[model samples]
Target: MKNYLNSTMIKITLMIVLCMSAFAFNDSKVSAKDEAIDLRAKAAILIDADSGKILYEKNANKAYGIASMSKMMTEYILLDKIKAGEISWDDQYNVSKYAYKISHDTELSNVALREDGVYSVKELYEAMAIYSANAATIALTEVMAGSEKNFLPLMNKKAEELGLKNYTFYNATGLNNKQLKGMQPKGTPEDGENEMPAKYVAKLAYQLVKEHPDMLETASINKKAFAKGTDDEIMMTNWNYMVKGGIYEYKGVDGLKTGSTDFAGQCVTITAKQGDLRVIAVVMDAKEENGDSTYKARFDAAKTLLDYGFNNFKMQEVMPAGYTFKNNKTIAVKDGQKKEVAIEASKAISFIANKNTTYKPKLVLDKKEITAPVKKGTVVGHVEIQGDGYGYIMPVKDQATVVTTDDVQSKGWFVKALGGIGDFFANVGHSIF
Candidate 1:
């Protein structure tokens, strides 16, 4: 029985070792090189989500009217509500007279709610997020909480929480509204271009990608239709044709929202990823003069941003201190209780380059020694990394898992008795979170 049990344990341990080894090997192979692409937009941005780096920009700081992009913010605020337990996916609601009226008043995109039966929040969220159904969005606002009047406050408050400095929410559907009499020009220049809320809308959409990327599965979907069930019935199609059928090559091309109004022209917040890198592309009110299709300009600018990010960036592994990129020495342990522990990184490491620079990275670990009851992945010291344009550090950790130590290499007399106090507090933060 002892021999059988010993063989089983060794097999299980080796399997775990192999799995971890695969993940570690994969981490070291990240590499990329940027290739030029075309863009056509008056004001656009391709932003790197991890480092907040701007990969490409055309009047990126300039703000203009964004049509349906506003829906992204509205969807974000709604998702926030869902996450915070303020609402549930299956929550039911009725479209009030006012909401129904607003939805039907003009040619704005709508899901066309009827008074027959209650509709679940899930159905409505799909209409707005996947289909950009404006009417459905208004109906949700009206039925879910009370009124768009009440919901707009919630939207503003969320904007503040996301640290959006220049965004604002006007309505659930984001149709350009003439400010009710007394409101100032929102500091937007009175260009008579019906100053659309582009920046605020893009920021809200950015929050969606930044805070909850899982929604992309739903957002990136192209089109779907509904059959008449007892509760509700509606048909919808994705307005962003590029997403449904066009050739966008970026990997993990998830979702966002798209918008267009004759006045608003073309606008979108597009999300895509390559490796660990994810990006958000935003464009508002393009002139459309550069191409026959306004969407061509937006997609072009979006492709420009995506290509710059994927082709130009790479991820590197900065080995822990007292360890090597290849492997670390069998570290000492306490009380003969030697077990394997991986070293910890001092910080999340990254480097960025653009058309102007080429770079190389070097690793620097702080200490060459370690002490234990060194739990696997316990930080003992640090290592630094320097690149052509930046520098980073890798922290050392307890390698060989440790236990109550009598072995002096694992923990010397002084360390066993006194040194673990700081570690206790650090461990508290890690364990609690």
Candidate 2:
């Protein structure tokens, strides 16, 4: 009986050990899943600036309220006009009643434009970019398109041109139309405000940097006095706290926009560069752990994305130029001096990838064979990298071109005729057999 009791006790101990082992295994899986970075935003996206490759995204396509961030589009249009010579930075704007009223409203960001004050485009742009001055943005819209009403279409048109699909611009300043106090753009409801998905917000920021890189010069300024030395001078501080010298100052953080409103919550779009890698992160409607929106929450979300990008990914050459495919090193060339010609990648292909992941490339040929006279640089196919979760932000295939390695001249007419005759005789002999 004692021996039987010992065996039963041993069985019970084994069962307990097995149960604990199973629980530990399940707990490990949960920990692994929890390790993924949480952006703490309603929508967010991370992308490589140079290549336009998307690295990470969460609910990036759903449109949400975009407050002062709309100033980016306004800034884009003004820059475009300046570049086209239709407007000059020194051009003066006579503040309208709408601008004057909004400028005085302490609830919004503004530099307090005087009713009779003549503000230069440069000063107003500085205020709008640095301080997110709502009145200054409205005034600039009037200068560009003659009125905020007229500017709305241009904003939408530019959004369409930039390949932004889900977006709406109700006003140039991104303010709720009700705040406009009956002066809102025509046809927009009083409750309307600008709205855009995180994807398009990142795209707009990308285009802004790509087209008007100098915009960063103004955006990077942490603080500036509007109309310095004048009685009307008002000190303007950049709302983008990530800029150098600001609270929550992050290294490598530069020109970008930040936004918040009752409907929009806290939001921010930031670009940071470390070495050769520059990343753009957009976080919309960020919420705290308790679900309350706070100014720091948006920056925290952006920081998480930026950290994840810089920490987990690196730009590495996946394939070099002149790389030859293993299975298709050479392609058949009909009616040429050589029966086949070697092909290789036209340019070096580099991509941002996780350190732990091994990405394999696949060659997709336009054609398996080519007719005579192929030039050395003739494009025959493209190379595509697989296993990367995201692709280029642009609506196109992520690929690099492959080209012929050397020229292949057509065979002489006599040689071609002889080869045709040989083929015919060979067929006849097979039939006879």
The segments of candidate 2 whose C-alpha lies over 4 angstroms from its true place after superposition are 1-35, 336-338, 373-377, 395-398, 406-433
Could you tell me every candidate's TM-score relative to the true structure? 0.61, 0.86
lDDT of each: 0.57, 0.88
Q: Which candidate is the best by TM-score?
A: 2
Which residue segments of model 1 deviate by more than 4 Å? 1-37, 178-203, 227-234, 244-251, 287-293, 316-348, 352-356, 359-433
What TM-score, to 2 decimals, does candidate 1 have? 0.61
lDDT of 2 at 281: 93
Residue-level lDDT tens digits of model 2 in 165-218: 778889998889989889998899989988999988999998888899888888
Q: How close is candidate 2 to the true structure, as a TM-score?
A: 0.86
- Give the worst 10-residue stretch by lDDT in candidate 1: 390-399
Query: Which candidate leads the pack in lDDT?
Result: 2
